[model samples]
Target: MYKGERMVLRFSRGQRVAHWALAVSFFVLLFSGLTLMIPSLAPLAKGGVARMIHRVFAVVFMLVPVYYALADRKGLQALITESFRYDRDDLLWLLRMPRYFFGRVKGMPPQGRLNAGEKIHHALIILTFITISLTGLVLWFGKGNLSQNEFLGMVMLHDIAMYIMVILTIGHLYFTFVYGALQGMVTGYVNEKYAALEHAKWLASIKAEKTADGKLPQSKSA
Candidate 1:
């Protein structure tokens, strides 16, 4: 894909590391969860193996955010702040989601570092993670320490969180694969053309800052 074209840093090394770590753990949990919840999937892992694997990844999933914050507090803070903010363009982006889903992004509104769909995805993940973590803890440690009603409530909440998480994860994968974003996560960089097209505003801000600092020359990529 590199034909001497300029490139942009779409993600940092730390960001990529944390993202992949969390993604891997999430997929493991998803598969194990499928086996635990469905009898037909039990052949995927047997002898309590799936549950053991799920627990191990659950710990990693719970810690990935803490690791990211410790490794790059500023980056994590910026991401969180952006995920909570919305604008007119965000609304437009969502309205035009059908086009995006079908790979017709030529006329979409310019996005920042994280696009509208990404912000929605992040918010959902955050919400579900909190709910799932709470319910998971209850299921793990509340055995015989709770009433039947409380136990059933926790189990129901946990199942609901998993449903949300699984659906979101599937959508995330679809967009990433369709848009060729996997390279950005793997290499921490993306083609300049792609970034300018999808995240023009964010790319412009970076260029402006670099120009102000006299650290970048005035060029097509700039």
Candidate 2:
């Protein structure tokens, strides 16, 4: 088994469970949603299976936000709150991040539990969920007689949203896989070195918690 010291519980068991549930649902929805996007692909006969799985997982996806809010309301609030106080240092850090990719920025900004990029990504996801849910509902069960033109408009909107989401999802997957950032979600903990380097402010919080308890908090290392 993997082991580590100076770790913190970034996500509770409930949060991790909810995250995985949503992730699985997303995969199902993505594949199923794709089948509907291309008319030529619809005639392949397996489109029905894809639609069925997508609809089932769409329902499951709804539980994610509920669980997250109930399980950790405080955390959720922190994640959503937008802070407007940005210093010149923050600007410098933002500009410098690209240098990190080229091994130029040796010591980047001491980030908080969530970095600026992560926060932006999270916000985009919230928007995506709202758009997808609303548009999907109209496609699935909207009443009132609509002209073919109106229906096509909704279909076009849904397709555009899905394509945008897919692009964002690809970026997310690249970060998680290529950069080894998925450990935070997969194991509920980040290594001390990683936390210190990437989330220094968060590491301070963990240290404070450890000091209060006189022991390190439990965490699963990837």
Candidate 3:
């Protein structure tokens, strides 16, 4: 932010906090939940400790969206809006995404702040959260209140959702590492050059707004 240095705020403080909180809670849930499915891991989850930990983290994970909505309303709303709305460039980006695995991004279509792939990831997370949370709650509290068949059905759905989440998380980490994007989450800033190359439309919009107002746009206050 000095006279010659250039950088952009890729994530705000509130967004960063919410993101890491959810991430930590997710990992805890994932490890603990995995013990239930893998018999060899039983000792680690012995005496129902893992189940207790899983349930605790599950509450934190499920509340993340609500926390984000309250803490960073504008950012959360913008992300939600962008995730559900797509255009020609998004379609083109989807078609060209495989090339991105090879570090070839130049020929890809111009991307908004959240690209098509990111939108899909977000959509998957949202849907998974709903399904997993509902099934989890039923499993946790529906005993005696629900039939045996109904309980078993919820358990099946819960496992399916967890598998989907695990797959998506792997892909998410792969892309994040390939792009060296973890810094943005940690520092809330990204190099201007990187932003220009990866999120041209969003960077251009920010510059345009700064030019028009003679100052950078401010994040909505929590």
Candidate 4:
């Protein structure tokens, strides 16, 4: 029998706040950005309302990194570093993910603070944010004196970035909101039993810390 009690505060209050800001801002960007893609929706994007809303949310989204840096500098650094580094094991895990979906793998890889899927998603979000911000600035500032080719290129790039973000957002929402991860964010506490089953390595570390000191361990890598 597992001799461990399982309860965890996954996200702190500050982190939760930052996540909400990022989520809301992304939604606003998605809706307003979509108008630019569909000409029939152009009217919805006009009159500066959508543009203003987009800019406001854009600023909020940009501040997620700033707040994360200031709130927990070390944790933020670790998250960035760990989210990118992938071992051979992680690649193998990706290859075997099909087994997981089919319930053939009895146990998944021993995930660290974040799993392979989370790392991939985080990396994609970071890349998309950079791409959108750069392309958005070009369009926002009015591509003046540029050739039609240059203008169209920026537009196409921006649209592609938006599409990527939208797809990721859908996945994120489905996994988090629809699949119960949202509770972890909303309450900051995850079901211990669930953690033990889904995140055995992390649960073990938590139990170890609890055994040493009647408190949960601070995450080495958030």
Candidate 5:
């Protein structure tokens, strides 16, 4: 609503903070974890530096969910709910996903707040997070107790989960830049037009929440 541009609150303050914390902690973990895995990157782990970094950020990484839950419980709930729900428009949208990949967002099927691809992405991230965390815990705490085969298996699962998340994060970044989505996360707001194009159903729902006096309803997703 500033500068005469009608803006929509795509995220809230709590959400923005949580998003940045997650992003920062994720990248740190990615690099440190890579250092531990790749022989060529072994030097980067000099004197266990990378291992220390990885372990420390793993704590931060796990704490992010708790922070998000406390800061914006309703928003977290909404996101989880939205990320699992899909409809017919989502099917049509998937068929045209290539157009979206190339930066075309217009004239596609109307989407909800989290679109279909986004839902899939979030769902995958959630699953991988669980996989990585559980395997990571076993590998960390069960070191001396676990047999060689069990240890190796846990390590394999942990690495696979990390690789999958790395791939997803790269795609996430690509789409972020292609679609210019950074602003929404930074400011918790987005242009109405953009919302209409990328999240028509969500925008309509938000707009419909407006009161008779023109005030937005009390909502974290306003």
Candidate 6:
């Protein structure tokens, strides 16, 4: 940024806290789950230790929504609402996704706080989390009540949901590094150029809401 040019707030403190809480719990669950499934890692799963760890983190994973609601209800609401509310520009942005994937993002249509790809990714994450949580509950509580085939089906569904989240996380990490988006989550702010390039509509909204003293509103992201 040029000297004296202000950086824009991209995420609020509550938003970042909820995000990191989800991330840390998700990774812990993933690691413990892998130890249970992988042959070479079976030694780590012996004595039910890994199972216990998995159960503990599973509760944390399931509580992510509650944490987000308590921490930043407005941000969570915006994420859910904007993810499903696409417009003409969002469609245009989706059509130019190949360019985005290749890191050539300059010419894409202006996007809201979430671009089209992010909308799809966030939607899938929310959907997969719900499925995973439900299946996990059944596997945990219905162990004795469920028949053999029914139990197996619930386990399969749980694994599928986990696999989907794993894939989504990979893509998410790639884009974060590719676009230097980690700064936003880390500092709750982003460079003006980045805000313009990736979230012009959101930046404009912020500008429109600037107060008489030129201070920005203390609201959640988007």
User: Candidate 3 — which residues are off by over 4 angstroms?
Assistant: 1-5, 217-222
Give residue 64's lDDT in candidate 3 (0 to 100).
Answer: 88
Candidate-wise lDDT, in order: 0.85, 0.72, 0.85, 0.74, 0.85, 0.86
Which 10 consecutive positions of candidate 5 have the poorest summed lDDT? 213-222
The TM-score measured for candidate 4 stands at 0.84
TM per model? 0.92, 0.82, 0.92, 0.84, 0.92, 0.93
| Candidate 6 structure quality by residue, lDDT tens digits, 151-202 | 9899899899999999999999999988888978988977777878889998
State the displacement of the C-alpha of residue 38, model 2, in Å, after optimal TM-score superposition.
3.9
lDDT of 5 at 53: 89
Give the alpha carbon lDDT tens digit for every residue of 1-222 in model 2. 224555667777767887798888888888777666678767643737777777789888877888888888776677667333344545666778676545443577876776665665677777877778777788778636667887778778777777777787887786666557787798787777777767787788878887999876654444
Clashes of 4: 1
List candidate 6 segments past 4 Å from native. Answer: 1-5, 211-214, 218-222
lDDT tens digits, residue span 1-222, model 3 = 212336688888888988899889988988998897789997988899998998889899988889998889998898778888888999999999999877788988888888889999888887888999999998888767888889889989998888998899999999888888898789887777777778899888998998998987632111
Q: List the residue pairs that clash in candidate 4.
A: 6-192
- Clashing residue pairs in candidate 1 are none
Over the stretch 101-139, how does candidate 5's per-residue lDDT look in tens digits? Answer: 898888689998888889989888888889998998898
RMSD of each: 2.6, 3.3, 3.4, 4.1, 2.8, 2.8
TM-score between candidate 1 and the true structure = 0.92
Candidate 2 local lDDT, residue 92: 62
Where does candidate 6 have its weakest 10-residue lDDT segment?
213-222
